[model samples]
Target: MDDIQPADIRLMRNEGSLRDFLRLQMTNGKARNAPAKPPPPPQPSDHTPGAWPTGSRPPRPIPQAPPGAWEAALHRLHTDTQTGTRCECPGCDPTTGSHPDAA
Candidate 1:
């Protein structure tokens, strides 16, 4: 009675009994205590950004050719001064088929 206020009286429609108010409070309390619904499982899509898939290694950092071939051609021109375009690394870096250290 002392806890009841004028606003509570208005909520009770001024005609409902105290039992009705208590029932309403109990209903609200139960609603608040109800377990929240679990979040939906992850949607099937491409890998999650940078997250790695299980039992899988990170992606290999493959060397990508530049947008243009000029740099590559220039590199061959400068480094293969003697072999020209014949330098194939381990094949003929010095125009020798054997490893430089082996010789």
Candidate 2:
């Protein structure tokens, strides 16, 4: 029988083919009938409290857009209307030089 290392078993598990590999190993007398040992639990860290368990820093808060964003957008829209760029709605084509809202 070929010598199979524990690392090979771990590799098979990581590759998501452990079940089929284990069956083949059993058939070939390379593996025992006993169940495999489970992986060890994650160790706790003594770093910053409320931080992520993986030792990575917590995510920063998303910054809010400027308070005048909507006002600035509206101002741009008003400027566009004053530039004779008529709205391209069904009957408001600017090429015809006629505006649906014009009296």
Candidate 3:
């Protein structure tokens, strides 16, 4: 296979043509020799383990409302406890059968 020549690799690939490359290389060479600026110091963080600022708790995640297994189980328990069509209101007894699990 023939190796692609630099001429063929120019403006076709958004490459700075040979002239732009030469200028960039010269500029890069000068910058490479210059001293690098010192890095900035790290800023202090408010993060503290087990401690929240102003007595506030860490933000809870947004409620997705996507029921997980526990939520499903709780819902099942709640639904199962509901006496459908039986009218399981308070002060009603299992024998009376107003509410299934009111007791």
Candidate 4:
């Protein structure tokens, strides 16, 4: 018996022949039928105002008082509240541990 050689094969380049080959292949099945992949999970919206979603604590607000400037801060606290230079005003509490005279 004689075996067919590579030289005996010829490539059909005609559109009709190519289309017929594709149609036959489709009817039979794919050479390697791949499973349909699931869609990816939706990502979270990153528009949050703070770092609450990062599994860490959010940052604190900035303090109005500056370090080593107690006198200047007292002046600012006094002026911002429209009080005179004295820290003894009824509404100005320089050490109450709360926002001063914001009323």
RMSD of each: 14.0, 14.8, 13.8, 14.4
> Could you give candidate 3's per-residue lDDT for residues 17-89 as a string of tens digits?
7676567778988998999999987644865656666567788898756646554444344332343443324
lDDT of 2 by residue, 1-103 (tens): 3788999889989999989977876776744565789998765656455666664667899998898776545444442256655254454433334556664
Worst 10 residues of 4 by lDDT: 7-16
- Give the better candidate number (1 or 2) by TM-score: 1
Error of 1 at 21 (Å): 1.2
Clashes of each: 0, 0, 2, 0
Candidate 3: stretches off by over 4 Å:
1-16, 39-103
lDDT tens per residue, model 4, 17-102: 65665577676566347666799877577646544776777688987766758855654565334433455545554555333445
Maximum-lDDT candidate: 2
Q: What TM-score would you give candidate 1 relative to the actual structure?
A: 0.30
- Tens digits of lDDT, candidate 1, 21-47: 789788988998999999988965765
lDDT of 3 at 75: 38
Best by TM-score: 1
Which is better, 3 or 4, measured by lDDT?
Answer: 3
- Give the Cα lDDT of each candidate: 0.62, 0.63, 0.56, 0.54
Question: What are the models' TM-scores?
Answer: 0.30, 0.27, 0.22, 0.21
Give the local distance difference test score of model 2: 0.63
